[model samples]
Target chain A: MDIAYFPGCSLHAMAHEYDTSTRLVCQRLGINLYEVPDWNCCGATAAHSLDHHLSVGLSSRNLALVKDMNLKQMTTPCAGCFNRLKTASVELKQNDDLTAEIEKLAGISLTGAKEVEVAHTLQVIMEAVGMEGIKEQVIKPLNGMKLAAYSGCLITRPRAIAQFDDPEQPVALDHLLQALGAQPVHWSHKAECCGGGFAASDTDIVVDLGGQVLEAARQAGAEAIVAACPMCQTNLDTRQRAIEDERGIKYNLPIVYFTQLMGLAFSYSPRQMGLNRLLTSPTTLLRSRGLS
Target chain B: MSADFYKPMRLNEIDSSLQEEIKKVCDINVELCMECGKCTGGCSNAHIFDYTPRKIVQLVKLGAEKTLLSMDALWTCVSCQLCVDRCPSQINIPHIMDYIREKAHRQGVKTRRINVELFHDLMLNSIRKTGRVAEAPLMLNFNLRSRQYMKDAVLGGRMFLKGKLSPFSPVVKDIDHVRRLFKKIADNREG
Candidate 1:
């Protein structure tokens, strides 16, 4: 199960924990992740917001690199990057004019680029390592830790671009948590927005929307929130205290990456999964469940 | 409140160029929208948007270019795609938002939320320089430029202690390729 990996910008810096856990879990699952060499940023919300051609061109450059790696599939841990790369790959394959334009703008030949498939890291794990396969490797079950599976936007969004899982009501993360012996609570804001790129530009939006997600997770009695996207994890974890201060309520729920939980279930240490990097600590919750 | 509220719009005089442009650029037909408020109902940021998703679509059909380009919704939209997914006609409001936003940016329309566009520009400048975004430096510059210097100072210190803030920025091996792509796109947009 060899696949090309694009950790994106956040994985290298803010979401380094996601990168660590993803690599560790993938290795344990016998999945070889060959990183796309010298990949550029996916342009994210910026490029797409300002210029559509630049957005497609940026991801097309990475797609071209994947073809050069001779890999048929690529996976990214960041949902934003996955969305941009997947959208580019889909558009490049479907629209000849787009392929030609992207080739001209990016200076990369898309001769066999149509063969390259883009998928989120969660999709890779679910497809390559099935529920039975994951359960077989769970040396340390979650001990019934209640978790809110926060798929966030971009992972299962726009339907046409992501092309995996339900956009409105995603359950892949919940199913994965169930395979790990964790109880995934039913929450309203599971697939809601966490103000994404607005975290830096406008803090109010994150405070408002992220507050809704945290409140929903807490109301559902989740011990912790599980996230697959770096932005969502960052927003929910970092801005939680601010949200609490604003709403006059306390939500001490830690936002953990799905990969981190998978690593824990696979008997990896908390340090190995970079669990301490989270702002809202999950140590207490994990300890209470006797799974730390 | 005003006489304009009771005045009927001259349907034949309404401009359709913006609608045509949207169809040409995004391949989304504004006319397909049945004025269902499902988009606004499920919108994550509709509460903050000056013009809701349904109204934005209506404005597109009405060819309200000035309103569409200058609305605060252009800056506040989270691009969650919930509106498009929930739309009976799949109008792609997010894409429409993007198209209008890009146009607004090009026209240099005054954004109601200036910091949002500023942050985006800063991120793009970082990419233009390093071929990748350096989160630590980018955030610092954003704080400095946006005059919100103390915005995340506490979080920064905590993250720094945890070794989350890397000082070194990542530069791609072949930087010229990225610069060339950026230059070409800018030139294309201008020409």
Candidate 2:
């Protein structure tokens, strides 16, 4: 199946691995991701809080761009971008007056644009790609590997917007892990917030609050935490050091996007999954078990 | 846990017009509070607040505006959306807390440290100027405001090196269009 893709800003910059690996994995899964030409920033958390209309306007511009491309479904790898795009789509659909107002503001009509569907990279993999297909492609199944899934607030929350899974306790990632032949650790803080942009804007809160999710994952016996969003990956992976210092506890959990795990399951090499970008490498762990 | 554990600040003890505005906006149904302690149990920051979420909601239900105004619990919410997410009665407890905090600001109840107020000023100032946030200015302004000017020095400098974080705020094309819409919202809200 073919879908329009909007990678958003972070995927190009910080989460390049997610972008590349998703593309490669999608190719392996017989899915085509055509970029929405001239796509702009999704206005993420910044625009949403400051100017409500501008946030919707920015996201609508991208949605309209995808609609203009004649693709009804636009897949975004970043959870935050997906949330912003999906929420804006719902808002525009529900409030026509506001939609018209925003369309006029942008000088483009969203009238008759195909109903654009926004979904994360995971939804396409689990639902569209199918577990049986993944099981067939597993050159290296992560057998007996205990992993925890950490889905921060952006992907699951504001449940009215992204109705992909149960917001309170989602098992999409865990189910995907099992399909790849890995054990998913059970934990309660799956839908918790990793302080979002607060990690960059506010260090103290990130340390205190981000630590809670990490501890929950660790206590649940997860060797590594798997995530789909770039921000969540950066927070849990990049900021693990700060959390350890602040809390005086060693949490050497590896943060891997589900695509990287999928890449491995598809029999693709770690290099192809961009596994080298990880702060905590899964090479030693995967190799120790002769899987890598 | 203990009876004396929660000591709410008395609103009547502190007279402030800002508090009155807060009370007006919150419009919390003070009488409906069951003191069931659900909000307190679900709150992520109950440990930080002298008054738990249940106490705050109860205070609002009781029209204990002044006491609610002075409590630190009003500012502690991270806006995680969990309290409202789990509220069986579906109370918008966090929005009420934000409203109360805005009132506290008008009444000169502020963070003892300028560091935390840095975010408030940056977010509001950015919104006030553009009716939209410009990420470049927001981060630069935050760094300047918080005196963490050196914190993002290497990384931000690298971003500048890569031509990412430009020195100027990004102008969303035809921002006047958005300004007018914001004006309409303001007008309707006032009406």
i-RMS for every candidate: 0.8, 5.3
Residue A151 lDDT, candidate 2, scale 0-100: 72
Interface root-mean-square deviation of model 2 in angstroms is 5.3
- State the lDDT of candidate 1 residue by residue for A1-292, as single tens digits: 8899999999999889899999989999998999999999999999999989889888888988998998999999899999999988888888899889888887888876778999998998898888999999999999999999999999999998899999979989999999999999998998999999999899999999999999999899999999999999999988998999999998898999999999999999998999988888899998987767
Docking quality tier of model 1: high
lDDT by residue (B1-191, candidate 1, tens digit) is 12442468889978999999889878989999888799999999888877889988988888878878889989999999899889999888888988899999999999869999999999999998999999999999999998987988998898898778888799999889999999998899889
lDDT of each: 0.91, 0.71
TM-score of chain B of each: 0.95, 0.67
Place model 2 in a CAPRI quality band. incorrect
Error of 1 at B113 (Å): 0.8
Error of 1 at A49 (Å): 0.5
Off by over 4 Å in 2: A112-114, B1-40, B49-76, B91-145, B152-191
DockQ of each model vs. true complex: 0.84, 0.16
